[model samples]
Target: MPEPIELHHQGVERSIGCYLLDTDDGPALFDCGPSTTIAALKVGLAAEGLRLVDIRHLLLSHIHLDHAGAAGALVREHPALQVHVSEIGAPHLVDPSRLERSARRLYGDSFDTLWGELTPVPEANVHVVGDVVVGLACFPTPGHATHHVSYLDDDGTLYAGDAAGVRIQPGRYVMPPTPPPDFDLEAWQRTIDEMDRRAPERLALIHFGVADDPQRHLADLRLELFDWAEFVQGGASEEEFIAYGRAELADAGEDVAVYDVAMPLWQSYRGLARWAETR
Candidate 1:
């Protein structure tokens, strides 16, 4: 089992995390949280008795800042580090101007504080993933984002970014992180099918912790994703949708604030609304 190193985004616990595992080649990180949390990330790494340079590879699930924002910074410090991402996400990592602009527009004033710097990864350091990366089986797991992908370890641990949804461990409620610009219900359903087919023994989620039950967790995520999509399609207001999400979390005995920080309900609503509009 791969234990996650909590980055503690915005001082919130279990809101964002990354995993460090031994790959066939060497030590690799499943995801590196945003630059704002880099100090905390280093602290976590030091606790594990490994320095940044000791990590040879960074296996990114997507170009999303929260998942891979520290790519360039890490590479800059340790020139030997290699970053592996989907082909669709490769260009963005090399030149993050467009991605930064999009994210700035969405985040506005809080952009810097929330995500810190968006540095471009040197072209040489970026490796587009194929069927296999390091030692894990790499496969497209789009839905959370068009460029999203997941890595399956030999031990059946899926490095499921946001594709498997957000479920703060110890809390059973699974919330789909359907962020805008690429939230497709049909596509995500297919992704769910694909994940089920893979049959991972455990899911390594970036939002929080590792889930031991892949089947049940994925099933719950599928149902909640459809339910949220339908709710948005039916014209549920953002406030209503947020309340609905909070109610679910509250009922599950989970800390609403922690889950909110991990995956904002408003963003999910906007994504669902956009998808609904297309329909």
Candidate 2:
């Protein structure tokens, strides 16, 4: 299993991370943290004796800023890099104006500080992933986002972006990051079934670290996802939802602040609220 290179997002440990793994082609990154953490990313890569140019491919699970915000910046530094992303996500990478707008609307004043620059990855360098990508089984795993996908390595490590939910391990709690405009409970349930059917040995999570116990981790995620969705659908206000989530984390003996950094409880509430309204 590959270890996550902690980006130390906002100087918080294990809040955001990316993975560097070897592929049939060359060194590849599972997900690159936002451009704000590019400096830390370089430091982490240097510790592994690799420069930015040494990476040949970048496998993106989604186009969310935290997961792939550095795609264009990284490619600008290393033009030879090939970026493999879901078909729906390819165009967004080549032209991120709309993505930037939506994110700005959500993040408001803190946008620039949180994500830095949203550069455009040249279309020539972007490849829509198929059933296979750099020797891994690529498959759709939406519901977190319509464009969400996951890659299964030969070693049975699933590069599960947010589809696997957020679990800042060594912590026992799992929380779903159901961000707005695309948080479908039904779709996410099917995604969970698909993942369970494949039965990966481990999950490479971008929010924090790898989980050796996929079964237990996924079960917890499913439970929390449904619980949160139902709570929101039951008309829980933002404050009530936050309090509910904090209480759950506390009961589980997990660090509420760390989990919030990994996946904000408020954002999750908003996403669920939107989902409820739509339903």
Candidate 3:
């Protein structure tokens, strides 16, 4: 297969990216980015002489909006598209009422604007990752979210959704996206070790592009995950947390818009703080 194509979302330069893979069967999409960027995704695909209909497989790393919000839209457009996600997240996609309400509570008035229309994916089309996909293997890589999973192919390429953390650019510092409700530090550390054991040749991140150095990347990410959590544990105020996170992202060379839209600084800090408190 050719090099994976990166479909950059319009709002955030490198914050959210959906990758398209050319498989022996047909075109497969790794993550759908968000429902707001559905039009841009179509444009991106068209640039490569393709369209939404050409995508036969939809492998989601998780069911987070940034990763799988466009899934319902895509499946609705192409009824034949088979969506492969973690078993835990499959039901949420099928009946998104609770999910939608929870998201609205989090995002408030910005929910519709940021995420757009989030329709329910038919239960018939949704299948657990390992249960359906022929050759691809889905490993339960939680920590980022309870419903998170990473896809591993025969060539040692791992489509490590958020379980691998977010790397906006190569050579830039890796940032931990410890968002609320399910950011377990222990689980995340274990997941990191598991990823290292797998020794993937390349890690395709949903946040941005690919990272070739698995060893160094995982090590840096692991250390930062702990370091960030420690920082949050120091009893910093919400403002302090946001300021610190903003500076770190800026120092890493990410744009202001990318930081604002993708970082979710306060929410991430809250997640880490909650994890630390509960632990």
Candidate 4:
């Protein structure tokens, strides 16, 4: 029997976890996490009676170190593996210079320790998902990153790459992942409203699992994102907003597994903060 795709939980940073899918096409890891989480991913897959070598496709939401710092590493490890990413995000994976430089600004010396060496995915190997759907459409999500994209599957489950916002609490509280260089509240809401029209049954977030209650998720996300934006716009500086955002985000009461999937959601926090400053 060809097994259905399964979402494997690779807990990252004591707070977040990565969601990988196991399909008949072969295992597909959505995001790699900071290189630190690969071991956890392997462990998660093993528990499910699988292994990393089973991964033939690495579908990246974006090229942020947290989402795909190990693209090169993965391809290196699995020579036959290919990567699927947004057209806008394809070059970074193929070149990785801007990606590395940006990460350096945020993580300095710890970048290497945290994200391992990242080389480019060969042009021939890069799959640039523009707006079409290979069973999933690339929905533009600007609040998170200029090149951020949310993948919507046929069943209406949107793989919201920080697009629908961050939901770390069980009661449905959400805050914008408006990391800098691309935090456009106007665009963010517009995108959400568009997704809302589609009425997805669930939202698969990069930092965690799925959100089936789209309305509650959208409502909570809309309010909180703007709230954070207003808070940051008030008087806090970039450094201050990041420090404050991290502290505030901790109060979210979801399963540690929710956060366990991705650590230092701070990477998003830092970027969102930058967006706040500009807006």
Task: Return the clash pairs for model 1, or none.
Answer: none
> Which tens-of-lDDT digit does each residue in 64-144 have in candidate 2?
999999999999989999999999999999999999999999989989999999999999999999999999999999889
Q: Provide the lDDT at 230 for model 4.
A: 76
Estimate, for each residue in 1-279, the C-alpha lDDT of model 4 and write its tens digit. Answer: 111122232323323445566434666766666565566667766876777778777777777776777788767777787788887899888898887887788778977766677777788778877675454666676656667777766666677767776665343556566555666778878877887887888887654457778888888788876776676667666567656655665665544344424434455555555665565
Which regions of candidate 4 are displaced past 4 Å? 1-14, 22-26, 169-171, 237-279
User: What is the overall TM-score of model 1 with all chains considered together?
Assistant: 0.99
Candidate 2 vs candidate 3, lDDT winner: 2
Return the number of clashes found in candidate 3: 0
lDDT values, one for every candidate: 0.92, 0.92, 0.81, 0.66
Q: What is the C-alpha RMSD of each candidate to the true structure, in Å?
A: 0.7, 0.8, 2.0, 4.1
Local accuracy of candidate 3 as per-residue lDDT tens digits, 1-279: 224344455554677777787555688988887788888788878878988998888988888888899899889999999898888899999998888898888789988878888989999999887733646767888898988988777787888988988877654677788988899988999999888887888888877678888788899889998888888888887788888877877787766566556667777887888887897
TM-score of 3: 0.93
Question: Candidate 3: where are CA atoms >4 Å away?
Answer: 1-10
- Alpha-carbon deviation at 59 in model 2, angstroms: 0.2
| Candidate 3 residue pairs in backbone clash | none
Question: How far is 133's C-alpha from truth in model 4 (Å)?
Answer: 4.4
Which segments of candidate 1 are over 4 A away from where they belong? none
- Summing lDDT over every window of 10 consecutive residues in candidate 1, give the lowest-scoring window: 166-175
Give TM-scores for every candidate, taking all chains together and pairing residue i with residue i: 0.99, 0.99, 0.93, 0.81
